[model samples]
Target: MNKRLYLELENCIGCRSCLAACTQCGGHDERNRNYVYDVNPLVNTQTMPLMCLHCVNPACARSCPAQAIQIHETGAVLSALVEKCIGCQNCTIACPYGIPKFDTEQNLMYKCDLCIDRSKDGIPPMCASVCPTNTLQWLTDEEIERKQKQFNVKNDKWVTSIHLENETNVRVNLPGILQGITKLY
Candidate 1:
């Protein structure tokens, strides 16, 4: 199945539109919700949008005593059953990426659903729709693989190897380099 938010960090601008969209999506006030955080690298200025990785084997889902989180059929999106959650925060602690945010006001944990509701209407997520630059594009696994293959052929390099190196290197040189590089969660 197609699952994964393939990010081109080099193309990302420091705009907080994605973050704003995510917060609004999660039913949080503009002031309180920050699903994505902006990071300024020592060398450059770029906003890295942070959100749940929605891993194939999600630590949050495994750790949830209430079994509130479930992966969609596509496997890219994850949703939480707020009613089932007891605000234990086990998912939050289990997540290594720290993408899940705890809303003390609501006494529930919220995270990025990858805008599945919007996707059902065949529209891009709010973040992708509002991105000033065409950096963040949502695509299925097959589409991403095709692009990666094309990129490799054009560059005369191995895309998978580049990705592997990128994944291990926590100290990225460019801004937003770490957007989807880590599988921490």
Candidate 2:
């Protein structure tokens, strides 16, 4: 198992704390993973977070000319190596999931390293740590199995019936989790 971040898209409230937490300005870790993005889920008044799938066969690593990208043994894909990265954006272009970003001012590329510094000590990533609704999570083996069994939504399509304060009914379609996902009904 790759053992990366897993998101329960239905629970996300679009707070952008995950996005903010990914950035240094949010005041968590100094170096920015800066990978999370928000996208429409074909529904009104809602969005879902997206990030690197950190593929078993990563296009970013294969496409790097500078050989800056490295996949850790724990399956976390690190951001571009500062000394080796030429800021070519090859990884960005080559990524099937479009996870990488080039920083113009810094002249380097950045992506989620799964918070390697923190996770090494068994800490969850800042995004997961800060999520208010537990929308985003990192699952253990037992948790993964439990979620997989409890939730019926597959990777292809996502739906969660929600009723608003005004009793407005909305039907939403989630694209899928970036990596592994499980949810509680």
lDDT of 2: 0.64
Candidate 1, residues 162-183: lDDT per residue as tens digits? Answer: 3422231111122223223432
Q: Which portions of model 2 miss their true places by more than 4 Å? A: 1-3, 25-43, 152-185
lDDT of 2 by residue, 62-106 (tens): 899989999877667778888999988899898766678888988
Scored against the true structure, residue 56 in model 1 reaches a CA lDDT of 60
Q: How many backbone collisions does model 1 have?
A: 1
Best by lDDT: 2
State how far residue 25 of model 1 sits from its true place (Å): 3.7
- The Cα local distance difference test for each model comes to 0.57, 0.64
TM-score, one value per model: 0.70, 0.73
Top model by TM-score, which number?
A: 2
